[model samples]
Target: MTMVRLDDAMVLGMNGAQRRAVREALVVAYPSRGRLEALLDGLDRSLAHYAADQLPLPDAVFAVMAGAKAEGWLPLLLAEAVAVTPDNRQLADVVGDFQVGDFQVGAATTGRAPTTPPSDWAVIGALADEFPDLPAARPLISQAGLPPGRQPAWNVADAETFWSEVHRLLVDGAVVDGWPKVLLAAHRARPANPVLAAAVSAAGATGNPGWREISGRP
Candidate 1:
């Protein structure tokens, strides 16, 4: 494998292995203790935000909708914002515009008018450009297998099925809401399955804050 320099910007076109190698190179590229500390701080902040369940949206959604409460669907919107801006402030701005009709979410498919459009890609691209090395974020839900107006059913699915579906969702890098609850429910369903227990523990270690929150871990 070619040891690409950490400074390489050509990573945008590199294969998955190359990208993984480049990320690993960061440790050697910034050898200073101070640099490493700064890097650690940045990683912590980003991971915490990414793993968080409720990303704060603009206060305007409630203001405009008049008692419009956040439903399970709202996290789907926030996940879309997170695909672009992981920071609460930036996410708030994107979501603010989203709520108020300034930022538009386009649908994944075209031909007929979509019930809800996907997150605005132009804005997401602009944000990705500003944030170095940030992979464009995607919604937690997959556009595939979706009916025109229906929501995903993974939320209420049984443990085995939820396990399979959630695994597919994460592997595909799609966003999912209430994953912790799903996991806990799965655990409850298979309390005696040591393999499942181990898998659940490993899932939480992925730096998702919501996992711990729902699992009752620190």
Candidate 2:
């Protein structure tokens, strides 16, 4: 069989008016042999804009933004959730799947900062061997269910955003350990810093209905 692949936009119906408008803005709204970067900025704008009304967390919209080039311009993509299961934890494996190096969807970055840096398509159990106490580490490894590397390490990348994403996942209960008592305890004990206070509050509110507004633009 002469197999063929289908574009997510097509099946998801990005050709419609409202969506088309957003797509046209991104330029890659339709497939072409053009620079993928061209559509990235526009996609970022549309996702951010529409997210205010209805979060871009819908599968179609989420795929468009989450799958974009993450490294060169890291600011564009945010913590968009793809699905939510019965579990109280917000469904955001997509965020953990991302990498600062390769464009793979379910990649991970682990280990001490300024050292391990980042790796693509991580297996959480193996990565957890280092931290030993990171609640979310192994779950991330098992959940991503990564196969043998489709693309081997070209070289280590910055992994800055990757670290943050994983941390957010850990705090939100995406990982196995997902220590709320530890997190809340530390959060409460923090110095009476306003910024930290706000951070703590925001951290507490993830996966809430009200906060869904910018869920995709998270």
Candidate 3:
């Protein structure tokens, strides 16, 4: 069977609307709804259809998982969960057979940056300032070599917007260490940031509700 996949563009396109739809669907799919494994199974089963009445279930499921800041093992776990499904069964018995100890949910990484820069000098400079450790940010900062406190008079508002894109890239799978902590710093820098909020909310939905508590919001 072909495994379901979510690409960069699709994951980046997730928004509040899709998140809400998935949540509602989950409530119905798993009424007991306590286990993360069950939720993962439901999501995988839902995606087998991929589309229902024009609503894209895979996109919504990916939106939720990516927002959750799941580790690199997520794809591996999903693959394992789906693989065990009985050919004669309707829905999978993933949760019953799942053995968390059998898998390692290690650090997530997006691999590398593109050879070509995607942002303008000002935006890149601002990102470098914000996340100096980021792989993509480092090269831009080096090439521009804009002195400290000498960045172009770019619009600060646009920096916030761009930071959302950066957040998406990181959580979606960057060589991030302590991803939750990184998210906290991002939220601190930009209070009420939608992207940050979405990221936090995603993490909350997937058993790790720490982001919600740290952000001090429901």
Please provide, for model 1 over 1-218, each residue's C-alpha lDDT reduced to its tens digit, 9 standing for 90 to 100: 11111212231234555433322222122212233234334333222322222211111222211211222232332333334333223223323322323232321133223222112222122122221121211122222222223323534423233334444554454434343334444444445432233344545634666555444567
Order of candidates by lDDT, top first? Answer: 3, 1, 2
Q: Name the runs in model 3 displaced over 4 angstroms.
A: 34-36, 39-67, 70-218
Error of 1 at 147 (Å): 14
Model 2 alpha-carbon drift over 4 Å, by segment: 1-159, 171-173, 176-189, 202-218
Ranking by TM-score: 1, 3, 2
Write model 3 residue lDDT over 77-186, tens digit each, in one string: 34443443323111122221222333312211432222121122222233333443434333332232323343223343554344445445444554232345454544
Global fold similarity of model 3 (TM-score):
0.21
Give me the displacement of residue 201 in model 2, in angstroms. 3.1
State, as a TM-score between 0 and 1, how close model 2 is to the true structure: 0.18
RMSD of each: 21.4, 18.7, 16.9
lDDT against the true structure, per candidate, is 0.30, 0.29, 0.36
Q: Candidate 1, 144: how far from true, in Å?
A: 19
Better of 2 and 3 by lDDT: 3
Candidate 3: residue 28 lDDT (0-100):
23
